[model samples]
Target: MGNGLIYVMAVNIVIWIGIAFYLFSLDRKIKKLEREMNDPSH
Candidate 1:
């Protein structure tokens, strides 16, 4: 039972980490687009 609980916790942590990274990447892309829209010179 203890081993199963550990595995569940680890999986949850990994999923959250993945979500965090995905959101971070998406934010960067959105910011870049906003910058380009604000300044067409680029």
Candidate 2:
């Protein structure tokens, strides 16, 4: 039972980590697009 719980928890942790990375990258891309829009060169 304890081992099964640990595996479940680990899978949850991995999913959350992937989500966090995706969100971070999305934020970075948004910021870059905003900068490009505001820049005179574009």
Candidate 3:
């Protein structure tokens, strides 16, 4: 029973990490777009 709990916890952590990385990538893309939009030459 303890092993099962640990397995579930590990899976949850992995999923959270994946979600965080996805959001981080999206934020980077948004910042890049914002920079381009604010540039006078764009």
Q: Tens-digit lDDT track for model 1 on 1-42?
A: 687999999999999999999999999999999999999999
lDDT of 1: 0.98
Q: Estimate each model's TM-score.
A: 0.90, 0.90, 0.89
Question: How close to the true structure is residue 33 of candidate 1, measured as C-alpha lDDT?
Answer: 100
lDDT of 3 by residue, 1-42 (tens): 686999999999999999999999999999999999899587
lDDT of 2 by residue, 1-42 (tens): 687999999999999999999999999999999999899697
What stretches of model 2 exceed 4 Å from their correct place? none
Worst 10 residues of 3 by lDDT: 33-42
Q: What is the C-alpha RMSD of each candidate to the true structure, in Å?
A: 1.3, 1.4, 1.6
Which stretches in model 1 have alpha-carbon errors above 4 Å? Answer: none
Comparing 1 and 3 on TM-score, the stronger one: 1
